[model samples]
Target: MSFEDEWAECQKTANQRSTRMQLNQTPDGNYRPGRAPGGDLVVHDNELGAIGNEAYGLYQHLRTQGDEARPATFAAATAMTSSSLSLGSALYQVHDNWSTQLGSLKEACAHISNHLDYSQKRHKEDEARIATGMHTVSKLYDYFK
Candidate 1:
């Protein structure tokens, strides 16, 4: 009704709302053990493999096609320098920068691909180890029974 009343009401409402971080919690503010409502970190083998393959594919494509304009660009830059154009040095710098950036992008892609492949392999090994341990535990439990 009044400005002071509205301000007090807004403050009360804001104070009633939660401001704490709710990491891996359910909607009712309970902490779920295995998976929360937001879900757990799940990376399937096929998903990892697909991402790695895509990264590798991108790297391969960049390696083969990224430098297609290098020769022409350099030649043009050189010709411009020979013709006494002031922008020749800038053009050459641009070409160099482009090459550097392309190399960096290719390296990044390769790294992503390799890292994902390694992670996938490691995950499978871990799962296998866990399964073996579980099976051994079950056998021991049955023997005791």
Candidate 2:
């Protein structure tokens, strides 16, 4: 209702979000115990991982080269050429390997389904957290009156 009230509420919610990010966690995908996929706050997807890492490398290289409007210098050209080729080759190999195994990788695909379940459960938990936060704030409003 008042500025002080709003500021306090904002600080309270921000603190709640920080705490949730640190304390909350989703269940791991099924993989026979020590073999489950490793990633935080993401559904496990091998193809996506390969693509993301390659893109990250490329982005870093581009930033280092600078964003010149015209053609880059010889040194920059050489840098980009080598890095791009290496990253592309690695990604291509991974893509080929997965593609070749597509038909025979039925068991691996089943694990993806497990990741789907994990993601859904995490989403529901997050919704509950939001509801709880709202209730807490509502009660705080009554207390401050």
lDDT against the true structure, per candidate, is 0.82, 0.51
- How well is each residue in 63-101 modelled by candidate 2, as lDDT tens digits? 454334223233444555578755555555545554445
What is the lDDT for 31 in model 2? Answer: 28
RMSD to the hidden true structure, all candidates: 13.9, 19.9
Worst ten-residue run, lDDT, model 1? 18-27
The positional error of residue 82 in candidate 1, measured at the CA in angstroms, is: 1.7
The runs of at least 3 residues in candidate 1 whose Cα sits more than 4 Å from the true structure, single-residue gaps closed, are 1-41, 137-145
Q: Model 1 reaches what TM-score against the true structure?
A: 0.66
Clashing pairs in 2: none
**Which residue pairs overlap in candidate 1's backbone?**
none
